[model samples]
Target: MPLLEISGLTQRFGGLQALTDFSCRLEEGELVGLIGPNGAGKTTVFNIVSGFYKPSAGQVVFAGRETNGLKPHRITALGMARTFQNIRLWHDMTVLDNVRLARSAWLGYGLWSAVLRTPGYFRAEKAIEKRARDVLEMMALTHYADEFPKNLPYGLQRRVELARALAGNPRLLLLDEPAAGLNSADADDLIRLIRWLHDEFKLTIWMIEHQMKVVMSLCQRLTVIDFGRVIASGLPQEVRNSPEVIKAYLGDDTL
Candidate 1:
């Protein structure tokens, strides 16, 4: 079965249609790319799937469960996790603390127990720390776990976001422009890490990436959207050669 399925999804903001009848599917353990020019509604689609925005019409079935209109937290509890376009780390917290916060969702402790530091709370905290440590190591950020987000380089900060998302134990991961502001070397590392995580964690990944290099190299399938609709969907090379995709990007000089 497909890990994700979207059919006839639409969203409108006033008179402007942000997404119109957008539909797509992702299979188990698949790594797919969502690419489009600026204002193509790529992020809008992500928002709908991640439960940040409700679709005006249609269904978002994830893991065979209808997810439309679900709150973001409820969607997350269903084994879906996402990273934002902008880094959302707690700038004041240490890297370990930031990721530990993500693991808190699964920690079995109540507010009173945590505040009182009961034996159960201590055990949960320890287990959370261990899981957070494992995630940091997986992302190769173990050495910098003690550093604050502001102290790390931009590339490492992005990795920290990935670590936090993974800390949630998601079956499906959505990344919005994971390589947005990185140098060539950093982008390359990000691509490798994404591929590595998919295999190691048995994850299905769906990402919105404008970096052609990263998208082409990392994704097994590609979906291109323009003007809030799918323009092309196929293998990377096929989508890259598509005239509509070329014009979509070419028409917008800023893309």
Candidate 2:
């Protein structure tokens, strides 16, 4: 079975329908791209899948179970995690603490155990710290682990967000506009890091990226949506050449 199955997803805000009959499937370990013009409801799909919004109609079958009414934290505990278009790290927290907090969500230690300073609580705390440190090292952010996120560069901050998401050990990762503020060099580096993470962690990734160069170089398949409906989906080259896709978003200049 596909890792994620989204069928006939529709969402409406009063009279404005943000998404209508949107559907797609992602297999295990596939790196797929979702692209569209502004207001095409690409992020809406992410919101629905990540439990930020409940769809008006349709089903989100993840790992063979329906996730329609589950909360975001519940979904994260179910092996799905996501990053936002903008960095959402806590400004006052250290980088290590930010990631360690994510892992703590699944630590399963009760409040009494934490407050009483039980051995299990201490062990869990130690494990969370080690996991956070390992993830930071993997992202090459060990040097900045003790620094505040506000002190880091934009690209490095983005990596921190990814590290926090990975701290939960998710099987599926949803990235929204990860390259939005990056330059060519930084975007290229992100692409390589994403590929490495995908292979190293055995993750299934679905991302919404406006940078054509990043999408073209990284995604094995492409899905294009416009006006909240799918217009094209296939191999990167095939989707790139579709006349409907060109007219809808890519335009004549895009490769």
Candidate 3:
């Protein structure tokens, strides 16, 4: 079975019809890209899959279970995690704390154990801290472990968000416009890091991106959406040559 399957996913915001009959699937260990011009409902698809918004119609099946109505936290616990287009790090928290909090869903100790300062609580806390540190080190952000996210550069802040998502130990990772605010050099670095992470963690990744260069360089397959409907999907080269895709982005004159 595919690691993630989104079938006939549709969303309507008071007749806006943000997405219609959208469908896609990701196999285990595949890196797929969703690309489109702005307002094509790419982020809408991410929101639906990650449980931030329930689709007006359709099914989101992750790991063979229907997830349309599940809460975001429940979905995260089910082994899915996502990074937002905008860095959503906790501004007040230390970088290490930000990543540590993502592991809260996996904490084994109960509230009573925390209040009573049970041995289990201490053990769980120690484990969470160690895991957070490990993730930060993997992302090469250990130097900023004690700094606030707002104090870091934009690119580093983006890495912090990625680390937090990884802290969840997710089987499927959804990245929304990860290259949005990166410079050319930083974008190249991010592409390499993403590829490394996919191989190292054996994760299935689905990313939404507007930067064609980033998508072309990283994604094995491309799915293009326009006005909430898929206009083309195939290998990167095939999708790039698709007439509909050309017209959508470059207009009929180019076609």
Predicted model with the maximum lDDT? 3
lDDT per residue, candidate 1, 119-197, as tens digits?
A: 9999999999999999988788899999999988888899999999999999999999999999999998898899899
Clashes of each: 0, 0, 0
The predicted structure with the larger TM-score, 1 or 2, is 2
- Whole-model Cα lDDT per candidate? 0.92, 0.93, 0.94
Q: After superposition, how far is residue 30 of candidate 2 from its true place, in Å?
A: 0.4
Model 3, residue 227: C-alpha shift (Å): 0.2
Give one digit per residue, the lDDT tens place, for model 3 in 211-252: 888999999999999999999999999999999998889877
Query: What's model 3's TM-score?
Result: 0.98
Structural similarity to truth (TM-score) of each candidate: 0.95, 0.96, 0.98
lDDT of 1 at 13: 97
For model 2, residues 1-255, the per-residue Cα lDDT tens digits are 999999999999899999999999999999999999999999999999999999999999998889999988888888999999988998799999999989755886889999999999999888889999999998889999999999998998999999999999999999999999999899999999999988888899999999999999999998999999999999999999899998886466655
Whole-model lDDT for model 3 versus the true structure? 0.94
Q: What is the overall TM-score of model 2 with all chains considered together?
A: 0.96
Consecutive 10-residue window with the lowest summed lDDT within model 2: 246-255
Of the two candidates 1 and 2, the one with more favorable lDDT, higher being better, is 2
